[model samples]
Target chain A: SQKIEQNSEALNIQEGKTATLTCNYTNYSPAYLQWYRQDPGRGPVFLLLIRENEKEKRKERLKVTFDTTLKQSLFHITASQPADSATYLCAYNAGNMFTFGGGTRLMVKP
Target chain B: NAGVTQTPKFRVLKTGQSMTLLCAQDMNHEYMYWYRQDPGMGLRLIHYSVGEGTTAKGEVPDGYNVSRLKKQNFLLGLESAAPSQTSVYFCASRSQGTGELFFGEGSRLTVL
Candidate 1:
């Protein structure tokens, strides 16, 4: 069985700083991984997706890196703002199965 | 365009009660899924459908049943609700090749 693990602790960062979150998997490498932003009382919204063949992908101020050798994916939000505070989740697709991590709550303080 | 819509935004059910959660999508997607979210736990897949009239069990399919008779609607049912079934349910749909899921607002269910 594949397992996705994310830091359960809340990450606090000063506004305008870079926030990095980690997602580790224990099992076979997935074909692709995705990051989602979930605000309180709302469903998750897709932020970025990186394939196994790709080392990194960027969308505006958001970037995601997938390291198959390390079995980890790192999500970085550059120049983060107060409005960027939300729970970030990482999910992967392996064997056509999608599994999600527990998610890391990000708090960007002004 | 109502990408994915879930009915009964909030529901309260007693133990042994039965109810169904409705999910509708207008994007003409080929894949649909049902997941439940709990505190300290990430979203757990309950059931999924690859296409109309096809359904398969996901990671956590216990205590739930699903039907996808139509291409645009997927139904999740609880034959006998239990306290452990209390959680937020989300419905999602995605196209064939995109692999990006479009989720509904969510349906919060409480069982006592």
Candidate 2:
């Protein structure tokens, strides 16, 4: 069975610093990978999507890199602010089946 | 536009009680899904519908049943609730050829 793993521990970073979160998968590669931002008590909002053929993708201060060789994807937030605090989830779509990781909570402290 | 809407934002059920969760999407999407989220467990797909009157089981479909009588509506039912069923339920939909999913506010269920 395919499995997605994200750091369950909360990540604390100083405001203005770069925050990086990781998502790793096992079993097989996916057609695409996605990152979503989830605030407390709210549904997740799509942030970025990177295809298996694309090495990197960027939107504003956010960037996502997919390393199919490593079966990993890294999500980065540059010049992070306190408002950027939230849980980040990583998901992959294979044959139209989407699988999500447990997500990593991020806290940007001032 | 209300991309996706889920009824009964929250519910509390006793063991063995039965209830249903409703999901509606106005996007006219071809795909809709039901998922459950538990602490540190991520989101597990329970069931999904690809079109009106068509349904399929997902990763965690056990103990749950679904219906897609209408293209805009998907229903999830629990005939006999259990404590292990307690989790936040989310309904999402995506259009054909798109991988992005639009999610609802979520429905929190607690089985005591």
Candidate 3:
């Protein structure tokens, strides 16, 4: 069975500071990884996707890096705002199969 | 556009009760999936469909059955539910190649 692990359960950062979260996988080499934002009581919203061939991807204030060798992916939210607080999930995809991490709840405080 | 919608946003089911969760997508996607989210355990795939009339079991498919007779709708059924089945269910759809999933608001189920 494939396992996805997020390094932290929760992360707190001062507003305007960069927040970084990690996702590590074991026993699989996914072709691509995805990142999503999930608010309390709400389903997750897709944020970004990085392919195995691609090392990094960025969108607005968000960036994701995939290291197939390390079996890890790092998600970063730059110039974080209070509104950026939410649980972020990392997912890996193999063919049509998908696996998700437990997610890291991020809190950006002013 | 109502990318994806799940019916019965919340429900409480007694043990052994049976119910179906409906998922509808107007995006005309080719793939649909059902997932359950529990505390500290992200979303686990229960079942998924690659296309109409095709369904497959996912990582956590036990105690659940799914049907996708229509391209736009996928139904997840809980036959004889149990307390351990309590979790927030989400229905999602994605186009053929994008890999970007559009999720519904989620259906919260509490089994007693």
Q: Score the docking of each candidate (DockQ).
A: 0.81, 0.81, 0.85
Residue B63 Cα positional deviation in candidate 3, in Å, after optimal superposition: 1.1
Worst 10 residues of 3 chain B by lDDT: B93-102
lDDT digits (tens) for residues A9-109 of candidate 2: 99999999999999999978888899999999988888999999999999999999999999999999999999999999999875656889999999999
Q: How good is the docking of model 1, by CAPRI class?
A: high
Q: Quote the positional error of residue A52 for candidate 3 in Å.
A: 0.5
Candidate 1, position B83, lDDT:
99
The TM-score obtained by model 1 is 0.98
Give the interface RMSD of each candidate: 0.9, 0.7, 0.7
lDDT of 1: 0.93
| Reference-based lDDT, residue A41, model 2 | 93
For model 2, state the Cα shift of residue B36 in Å: 0.4
Number of clashes in model 3?
0
Residue B31 lDDT, candidate 1, scale 0-100: 91
lDDT digits (tens) for residues B10-111 of candidate 2: 999999999999999999998999999999799999998889999998999999999999999999999999999999999999767567888999999999
Listed in order, each prediction's TM-score against the native is: 0.98, 0.97, 0.97
What residue pairs clash in candidate 1, if any at all?
none
Judging by DockQ against the true structure, name the best candidate.
3
Across B34-107, the per-residue lDDT of candidate 1 in tens digits comes to 99999998999999999999999999999999999999999999999999999999999976777888889999
Assess the local accuracy of residue B89 in candidate 1 as a C-alpha lDDT between 0 and 100. Answer: 99
